[model samples]
Target chain A: MVRVVLCNCPPEDANRLARQLVEERLAACVNVIPGVTSFYMWDDELCEDQEHTLLIKTTEERYPELSRRLAELHPYSVPEDIALDSARVAAAYHSWVHETLSDT
Target chain B: MVRVVLCNCPPEDANRLARQLVEERLAACVNVIPGVTSFYMWDDELCEDQEHTLLIKTTEERYPELSRRLAELHPYSVPEDIALDSARVAAAYHSWVHETLSDT
Candidate 1:
């Protein structure tokens, strides 16, 4: 199975973190999408932030490690590091993702 | 039972489709993310596209309608409308999403 992890990070740290994940083989591909405006209630106040979202493609077996490593490397005290399940995917693309990883 | 649908759309039509989904209550929230580069094999040749991705937040029960509606409104001959399972989500946020939709 494959998982697409969404990590909300500060704009400054986004590119570096994306590169790190791919370099470490934690993710087959990491797309650093910039220019996102996040609005939410925090500490009894509505706060808005300009953040970047990292779209990570990796296998289920490597998910735990990837999550942990992301938290460790991420700058946020409380990171929105959630892994959404890939209910469906193209077989060929899925295979290609696996082949790109180190231990596949 | 929330679902996150990823739709690959041309940059020009992304925002309109996102608003349509929200207006029709097919999705509670649609995040129109720009600056995506997609590469795939089409017709035995490598194809590259600069597109935007729509991250739609909706419930599992409404998924079929959402998918159908998206395809009908989409400009692509075959839109990438695979719904990724929301395996986990914050309780408060999930409830908030449901409340925003008309059918909820």
Candidate 2:
């Protein structure tokens, strides 16, 4: 099954993380989208700031390995890494992802 | 909790779905990205084709409702509506998603 993982890291760290993931072939492609603003409550205070969002494309089988790599390289104590099983896809493109990563 | 749902549907069906979700406020915003090619195996056949991907932004609390709505309107027998819990975010932007949906 094909999967898409939604990940986020500090804006400053986005490029390095993306390069590492792509270099490792954990992702066929990593689109770095900026200008994302995030807000959450933590440590008894509500904080708000800007961040970068990474849209990662890969396969289900690679998730574990990919996730492990992300944890190792990620700067946050707890980085946002969520895997989503794609519901339906065009058959060929799915195969392309499988092929691309398999070659890696 | 802020959430991002990655959804794929036929390119032809993409616009209507995006408009519906936004109008209904199930999503604060829906980004329609085209030129996506997908491949998969089904019914003993490996097929390939094009698709449009929708990146939906909303709150975790609204997932069930959004998923249900997606199922009702989606063209595919099993549409791809996968919810991913965001791991970390800037404090204020997280609150914005919460606020936007609440107002809806």
Candidate 3:
């Protein structure tokens, strides 16, 4: 099974993290979507901030490592690390992801 | 359980679709991440395009309707409608999402 991990980071850090993930074989692909407005509560106060959302693709086998590495590298002490299980994926894309991750 | 549906749209139509999804109670929140580059295969040819990725938050019960509506509203003949099952969510945020959808 494959997982799509979602994380929000500041724009400055987005590209670097995405590249590192791929280079380190922690993720097969990381799509960086820039200019996102995220709303959440911090210190019991609602806050909004501009961020870049990363769609990180990897296999379930590699998720734990990815999560740990992400936490270590992410700028935030407690980054928004959410894993979403992919119910379905295109056959070609799924194979591609598996191949990319396993190539290491 | 709450779900995060992923869909990519042209920049021009992103905000409208996001608004309509929320207005129709199909989603509790829709985070529009602009300036995304997606690579895919069409007719055995690889293609890349700029798009806006939408992180749509909704519940499991409402997924079918949301999917149907998204297909109908999306400009592409075959849109990327991938649903990711949330493995875990913050307690406060989870409650907020449930409440927002249930209020309808």
Candidate 1 structure quality by residue, lDDT tens digits, A1-104: 67888777889999989999888998999987888644433442334567788889988877778877887898866566557877688999989888887574
Question: For every model in order, what is the number of clashing pairs?
Answer: 0, 21, 0
Docking class of 3: acceptable
Q: RMSD of each candidate? A: 6.3, 9.3, 6.2
Q: Which model scores highest in lDDT?
A: 3
DockQ of each: 0.17, 0.08, 0.25
Taken in order, the candidates have interface RMSDs of 4.8, 8.6, 4.4
True contacts kept of 3: 0.41
Give TM-scores for every candidate, taking all chains together and pairing residue i with residue i: 0.59, 0.55, 0.60
For model 3 the local lDDT of residue B22 reads 78
lDDT (10s digit) by residue, model 3, range A42-79:
44344557888898998988888888888889997767
Ranked candidates, highest lDDT first: 3, 1, 2
Model 1 scores a C-alpha lDDT of 0.76
lDDT (Cα, tens digit) per residue for candidate 2, span B17-50: 9999888888877898876544443342334456
Model 3 agreement with the true structure over B1-104: per-residue lDDT tens digits: 66988899999988788878877778876778877899999999999999988888888988999999999999999998998788755445567667767765
- Candidate 3: the clashing residue pairs are none
Candidate with the greatest DockQ versus the true structure = 3
